[model samples]
Target chain A: AQSVTQPDIHITVSEGASLELRCNYSYGATPYLFWYVQSPGQGLQLLLKYFSGDTLVQGIKGFEAEFKRSQSSFNLRKPSVHWSDAAEYFCAVVVSAGKSTFGDGTTLTVKP
Target chain B: GAGVSQSPRYKVAKRGQDVALRCDPISGHVSLFWYQQALGQGPEFLTYFQNEAQLDKSGLPSDRFFAERPEGSVSTLKIQRTQQEDSAVYLCASSSGLAGGTHTSTDTQYFGPGTRLTVL
Candidate 1:
């Protein structure tokens, strides 16, 4: 079974500061990884994903993630943070059957 | 034209009551999925449907949970005799195709606003 782990429960960053969210996964083979963000009272929105080819994948909202096969990690990163970036972020791993296993989630708070 | 849409944005049901959540996927989407998001937690996979066939349902927590996509376009998730623990936001997402193959899972999954179910 594929499982994801997000080490951070909550992270606070000042506006305009760089941000990085750590994510690790346990899978028997190469895994499909994804990052999603959820705002209050709303469903999750995709931040980025990594499947094959390039190790670095870019997504919406100025976010990006790099897939590291050796580390079994796909961490999300952003050059600068904004207030609107404050939300709950999730790291997920998809199995061959398309079943997605998600981490507990990390809540991001952008401080002014 | 629109993205995924779910009905009854909020549902309140007493314990032991039955509840049904509806999801209308984007037209032409071949894959639909159901997920459960508990308070302060990431969304958990509940099930997946490829067209009218339910290809995977290993994530459903219990037998009380049921889902159907009869026509392959719209899907419904039903919980029988809901328990207090069943209270959570039920989210629906749609993708372009089934898992595996050259198709990348990184493709965006359009999600609905979700149905917040409260089992008191």
Candidate 2:
């Protein structure tokens, strides 16, 4: 069965520090990839997505992701993290139409 | 201008009871989806609808789960005889879309504030 994996369940980073959240997927072909952020008591918001083209994809809120076909990974990154950036980040893959499989999210805590 | 909305932001029902959750997609959206999110886990796909047609329901965990988009605008997910395992946040998402195959940047799913369902 195809699956999405986010190894780190919780990560704590100091404000203004660089951050990276890992994501890996097991699928037959290259699928559409996405990153979403969910704040406490809120629904998810799309941060970025990767359909095709350049491996490096920039998304909203100063976030970017790189899709590595060899590694089967699409890791989310931020040059400088802010306090507001503290939230649960989810990596998802759309293997087929109308189907999106999400990995267990990584909860980031930005410490002052 | 407005995003997707879901009704009854929170629900609590006793085990063996039935419950219905509602989702209102953004206007003009052609695709609707429902997902179940357990604590500390990402949302899992439950079912999907395009317009008024239910295109895929393969993700539904059991027969007790039922979902429908009656008018292509609003949808409902019903659980018969809710179990303790059903205690999770139910999420609804909508995208300006056409059935499938065409994968474009414009067809992005916007999610609504999920409804936290608790089974006692």
Candidate 3:
């Protein structure tokens, strides 16, 4: 079965440091990819998405993701992390219409 | 504009009980979806609805799970005789539909605050 994987279960980074969260998917064909963030007691919010064309896509909250077809990965990156950036980040893929499969998610903790 | 809203932000039920969770999608949204998110995990697709028609339900785990979107505005997910394994957060999402009630994979999905269901 097709699945999405996020290698890092938990990551701790100091405020103002650079951040990268990895995501990999196992699918026969290239599918629509997305990154979402969820704060405590909140729903999942779309941070960025990559459908086609440009490999690098920018999203809200100063976040960006690059889709690498060769590696089947779409990793999220931030030039500088903020204290409020500490939350759970999820990587999802849409292999079919109206359906999404998400990874286990990576929990980010910002240190002062 | 109001985002998707779900009722009963939290629910606790006995092992053999049944429960219904409601979701109110954004106005004029043509697509609706239901997902199950367990603790420490991402949301898993459960069902999909195109307007008043249920286009896909292959993600539902078992027969005990059922979802309905009547009038193309509000949706409800019902779990029958819930089990201990049924404890999870139920998420609802909506996306703008294309003309003729069709939607593609690229549409951004707006999610609602999930309803946490705990079965003891």
**Model 3 agreement with the true structure over A1-112: per-residue lDDT tens digits:** 7799999999999999999999999988878899999999898999999888999999999999999999999999999999999999999998777689999999999999
Per-model CA lDDT versus the true structure: 0.89, 0.92, 0.93
lDDT (10s digit) by residue, model 1, range B1-120? 988999899999999999999999999998899999998888888998889999889889999999999999999999999999999999999988766564626556888999999999
- Using all chains and alpha carbons, the TM-scores for the candidates as numbered come to 0.95, 0.97, 0.97
TM-score of chain A of 3: 0.98
Write one digit per residue (lDDT tens) for candidate 1, span A1-112: 6778999999999999999999999998888888989898787888888888999999999999999989999999999999999999999997655567899999999999
RMSD of 2: 1.2
Show what share of the native A-B interface contacts model 1 retains. 0.65
Best by lDDT: 3
Question: For residue B93, what is the lDDT in candidate 2?
Answer: 95
Q: Deviation in angstroms for A61 in model 2? A: 0.5
Which docking band does candidate 2 fall into? medium
- What's the CA error at residue A102 for candidate 3, in Å? 0.2
Better of 1 and 3 by lDDT: 3
Ranking by DockQ: 3, 1, 2
Off by over 4 Å in 2: B104-106
